[model samples]
Target: MSAPNVTKSNLNFTELPFNVSDSNMSVTESLLYDDEAQEFDNEEKTWMFGAPLLLVFGTISNILIIIVLMRKKFRKSSWGLYLTTLAVCDTLLLYMFSLDSWLQIVFKVWISDETVAGCKVYRFVSYFLVHFVAWILVAVSCERIVFIYFPMKAKIVCRRRTACIVLGSIAFILTGVNAHIFWTFSLTEYDGFYYCDLVDNIAELMGPQFVIIFLWLDLSIASLVPFILMITCNITIIARLIQSDRQRRAATSDGAQKSSTTSIAIMLVSTATMFLILTLPVAICMVLSLNDEFTSTGNNMDNLYFAKRIAEFVQQINSVLNFWLYCLTGKAFRTELKAMLCCGRFSRTPGVSNAYVTRSTSATTQVEHKPKDVKTNGQDNTVKKAQDDTKL
Candidate 1:
């Protein structure tokens, strides 16, 4: 393939792959732009293979969450409503920004004409949803923290109506932020492919410094704040659980207190574990992006690209995995999942184990057996009866 003529108005490129042969070229389309040189074979293989997996897992898991929550019996809780909405948002993002873009990368084709409108829509959807996912996770963490620390207040504070309003408000704000992307870039045909790039008019106005600042600002809000909040909330939850266990041990040597404390601890630990596992890879990616070496356009580009992809893969896996944590730690979720899988045959009272149920039932029967005369005698008879029962 011969080099395209360098017009003064066009952006210069040093080289492209030889396979970009003479094809039906359009003057109105901009050169297909990649931030780094095309390592199509590697990039294609990764995104092509990984994307479908994300789509399958993300779709199935999120749908299951919606299904379980929408069941008539489980529809009342605010947390259930919030989780369902978050799953829906994640499902949309996975399909649009992740699955669709990745397929395009694999096919080596742009989805549409690289017009300003197309650019804006793509950037807006991608950027806004990316931030939206982070914020939604933050909301989830807050939900969990509130439930753990202030169960009574959480019931009142995070009701279904309020959750719906919060989620809607988040979507609106993010949509507005991303709407600007449409006005900035224009389509140009260069070489043999079409793409949208910054119009010279707009690029000159913002300058490189402003662009860098914007990128960092974007990173701070989407990544940094959410990461900090998740870590802090998870840590606090863990601390609360530990303190609860200590108090339970000191106050009650009884099995019921121990059992309840253990249940709460398990739930907190499992939630924290999922969050840490999912977030660690992303935090590492963010740190790597800051290093000048990792930000370079050549080999570093391939490394950083794949590194970010790995982070995203982990995040997608996280979405599916959290439900499992709920399954493992939550008696309610486990009962519900079992009931769903096995129909009504598996349906049972939540948190009823044979041994614990027997014990609790026996205790209740004992309480119901007090004599009529015991009440008339009051404190002396109560003490005497307790001593006689202990002797027996």
Candidate 2:
């Protein structure tokens, strides 16, 4: 009740789920709760065992994104900048989440529950990053929409400067918004063990209406609004892409443009779709759990919690999947990835004799030696055009 009871033999401390008082609970209900608890443990093990894989995978994948995007080809691309920032954020978010989860399950060390400051800071940091990442997805989505719908002005509208400003604004605003979590969560003790949770009298402290409003607000900021934007953007992008495909079909000279549009379409749709599928159930769980939080005796609480844990695990998979998505969907990304993996043994200037040309013509290099300036400019323009084409 006042956080999960430590002395209760049937109970275990977890930072991820909220607790309800066991007063007047039925034996059947207790058994049901224990059953749900077992299921959650199994779920935890599944993700936990996969944790190291994800750690290696998510780290290398996100790092690849960062490294690939930071290359000279994408240096001036707004979307490239956005994606690089996203990769960095995902790396941090994944580390924070996976490490906490790993520690909680393996060592049974709950950092948030260990100290009052730890409780608040942990919540604040994690919540801030979650909100931050969601909106970054939204930001990229909006930029993609702009690129698709308003291609002529995309360069003007979506610049690296603009991206940096947008990212800074998001971080600043979300920091202010999630800062309340520091005070909202307290290190609480029940039967000699600790939990990071709200006070039992939270309703009395903040008023029931305020807490309700806050939860709804939290749901909106963290999930609902972004989900709506993502779906909307996906729809708009698909339609525009269809129109572009038809138009490009009639034009013979625009073969390269067609390829670019296809790649962009795949990139946007795959990323947004992953978010939509994974986040939907999390939002649903939040909606279902809203009313139950106010009740002293939790009704169907185990079911709600089961749903929540499942949704959370699904959502987390998104962070690790983006690099693969880009690799699969973007031909250019695959080319670059291949080139990187092969260590440039495959790189050669088309139509130019390698022995006669003493200079490397690959776009990955930043040196502007006079002999290669022409090749560099040509590559830069091609990359610029492709970047412009990808805005949609």
**Best-performing candidate as measured by lDDT:** 2
- The digit string of per-residue lDDT tens for model 2 on 55-115 reads 7888999999998777655666676787788788778877776766677667866666767
Cα RMSD for candidates in order: 11.3, 8.7
Q: Least accurate stretch of 10 residues (summed lDDT) in model 1? A: 1-10
Clashing pairs in 1: 29-188, 29-189, 30-188, 30-189, 120-182
Q: Distance (Å) between predicted and true CA of 106, model 2?
A: 1.4
On a 0 to 100 scale, what is the lDDT of residue 273 in model 2?
Answer: 85
Worst 10 residues of 2 by lDDT: 349-358
lDDT of 1 at 382: 56
Candidate 1: where is the Cα deviation over 4 Å? Answer: 1-43, 112-116, 185-192, 196-199, 205-208, 249-276, 279-287, 290-297, 350-392
